[model samples]
Target: MSRKPMLPDGLSSYLAERWRGIGLSLVIVVATIWLGVTGQLGLYIHPRYFIFTTVMAVLGLVFVVSSFVYRTPSSGEPVSARRRAVALSGSALLLVIAAVTVLALPPATLTSATATQREVNSGGLDGAAAAEDAAALVGTGDYERLSVKEWVSLLAQSDDPALYADKTANVTGFVLPDAADPDNVFYVARFVVTCCAVDAQPIGVPVYQPGWKATYDTDDWVQVTGTFVSNPSARSADALAVLPTTVEPVDQPSDPYVY
Candidate 1:
């Protein structure tokens, strides 16, 4: 009886490696292009790098296609069957995981849950760039138009109530509770994305409102129109907190994060 020929262990391993490379490459390329096309790339990366990332993804895809077209001959060396099986199974598992994580999952931004993990305005805002931006806006005398980033920078410089008392703040962000006093203090905050989402930093202006959680829960997007006042809550670390005249629920903006 005649039997069908099978690939030698070495050739099988070689093909497995090629498939693994191609699968992972495809997952990354597809995810990048899909995010770009859908305008959801910003959820993961800064808006400035969007074009560069898309271009690189396109180049990667071209190379992947070229690799597929240009078939490679395998080395006819012997390999242990046990080793070959383990390698093949491992490659398949990796490919499946990459595909699921990069392609299958829905895109999302950092939430207040994540913001709580990091100290509010911990870093990246007290630096020159943010100070420069805030300085420009401060000159403009349009305090109402200032973003969470600018406000955070301004607060870091000086939390003196006199400096901000008359400067009305009309800021929008997700609600994140004050760790010191969750009852009477919370922040109107947004994640400041540096290079990418992994390096995002939460920065915000504190709001002093007793029974705030009864009206608005954590992570809810809201527009807070108020003026700064000395924080009433002794437990809260902030020197000044927004005494909100109105805290209205708002939809999460198209670009919820600050760059």
Candidate 2:
């Protein structure tokens, strides 16, 4: 008898079933490698994992490539027609979904939508530690150099308008509106990711800009430079806010997250 092909009708289901996992692995391997190569892996994963993830992906790819060269002989045990069809279709569906979701979607940093939904500064960022970090900058009078996170923490600790008075804040971040007082209070915000994008906590220096919505939309990156003063809006709960002297739209920073 002539040797049958590995994918002869009934046994084709076996190959599909066996290789479905491999197909999914291949998608992950390729996506991770490509993202790492393009310097976009930071969009999803933590920086610490960059080397490890890429290294493991390369190893996985080697296994996947080698597996193609050394195919195992298919078991010819008869499978019921219905069962065989289900296996083949299931594998195809899974592989297609994995490939499209992982490989086709462009890598992107988490946006302001995520910040708004999660409630900026709700994550347990330590106010005291933040205050300690900002202490050195306090005496230097170089307040414009303060970061959104540093300012948030310092403001959180004191909220005494006196502490921030006359201190100009020149900070850049995506706009995140204050949920309670949206029209008048919006944040010049950055996402603080402890481990990865998934754990990102939004921290911002509130900008009390009434009618800001008329000029800017949420997630619009801006550079705000002005002194912190008492929040002018009745609706905003923040005691101290940056009353911006210049709020100019700016391109999103190359790396938007604060690790």
Candidate 3:
């Protein structure tokens, strides 16, 4: 009878031991998927889905290579040492890539009002003013007076009445979709970029008051004077906030992009 093929002793065992790494890789993949679906990916170091997906793909390739190496026969040429070395090197490289990718990504906080403080301090009514107003409003217990839903409704209503009401305030941002009617109401938004445009996020206040369209185009630069209105049953009951105001067309100052 032909002798049974002698199997490598540690090969199977090594693969079993490395199963943990595979599990970890799977965890990362699942987490990436979850974040992408929930829009929570925008909260991460690299908010862009494509970036996150690329990093995950690299990791998956590493894991696949590891599995192949782990399953190779040990007795054929005793390449266990070389295989282990390669696995470790590959793992290290993958880790470095992930780290660098994350670090190099733009900071998602660019959309945050806190990140806009410098612009506000340097003679702009950007984030700093918004923060101050938000803080003051919150401090006076006025925030408790209206829910996020209420704020959206008040901002979406016909600006004709509000215009007559003389509701004028100041707001800063780029342009975006309107909360009430994206086609109708113009959104003044800012593209918040932490590191690059790849991970930039657009955040801003909605302007639906009369004459807003006349002064601002899709990407026109402008500073708006408006009033904050609150009413129940807006697009987003908890997050919709709008500013009904007269938009004053302004020059696109240097660094027009929020990033």
Candidate 4:
């Protein structure tokens, strides 16, 4: 008489029983790799963390592969159908959500609308410590290249705008109108992302150019070149009001943040 084939004992049967878990794990691995490869991860996180994140994902993938290959047999009988249904539902729900979010919503950079809603750190939250750090870096030379965060910190740390009056600022960022006074003033702002987009903070230098409102709209990325004029009405104390010599439209940089 022909005998019925038996289910493979050990890990293979275990994986087969909980195959949904394995499938979800594989999906995560694939999604991570896709994000890293496509460069879309930068839209959601700081580039500095990408390497570490990808490394961890790779390790997880390795674990998944080893587990499948080891094929340990389950000593116990298969789980009950009710329990199986619950397990499958939970795992499938998570996988579907993640997959749909990644695939359905196109990745996008946060705009000035978000800037208005979130805290705009013209001087930054670190207060004195950030100011000191900015001062330290200023000594490294090339004041023309001061970052939005540095300019913000400097203004916050020092009350004197005369110190920055003669300096020239060459910065790149999107425009955000000063809501209190939209026509004559606007901020050239960049978001600071320490880890991910969720924690991004806007930092900007205020520009005072007549007709600025007519010339540019909010969220227009531009290269701003200007002379610093220390003015308390400016965005911050260290932020000298930029009298833009040339506010030229430019394509957004590949890496838009201060770092």
The prediction achieving the highest lDDT against the true structure is 1
TM-score of candidate 1 on Cα atoms, chains taken together:
0.88
For candidate 3, the per-residue lDDT at 73 reads 41
The true-versus-predicted C-alpha distance at residue 155 of model 1, in Å, is 1.5
Select the stronger candidate by TM-score from 3 and 4. Answer: 4
lDDT per residue as tens, model 3, 85-185? 56656665665566455444433333324323322112222444445554555456544333222222233333334422433345555554454454445
On the 0 to 100 scale, the lDDT of residue 140 in model 1 is 89
Candidate 2 wrongly placed segments (more than 4 Å): 1-6, 9-11, 69-77, 80-86, 124-129
Candidate 2 is scored at a TM of 0.87
lDDT of 4 by residue, 1-259 (tens): 9653243344334644666777678778777777888887787788888998888889989988776677565668866544555665677787788777766566679899889987666322476666777777678767776777777777666646678766778888999877665667788999887788887888888888867777787899998998777543544333457888999999988777765
lDDT of 1 by residue, 1-259 (tens): 9653377655676766588888789889988999999999999998989999999999999999888788787766666666677777888999999989888888877998788789987875547888899889889899888888888888888878789868999999999999999999999999988789998989888999999999999999999999999999999989999999999999999899897
Candidate 1, clashing residue pairs?
none
TM-score of 4: 0.71
Model 1, global lDDT: 0.88
Better of 3 and 4 by lDDT: 4
Model 1 alpha-carbon drift over 4 Å, by segment: 1-13, 79-96
Predicted structure 2: lDDT: 0.82
**lDDT score for residue 253 of model 3:** 47
lDDT of all the models against the reference?
A: 0.88, 0.82, 0.47, 0.74
Top-scoring candidate (TM-score): 1
Per-residue lDDT tens digits for candidate 2, residues 24-137, read 888999998999999888777768889999999999999998886777766766675567667878888999998999888776777778877787777647666777778878
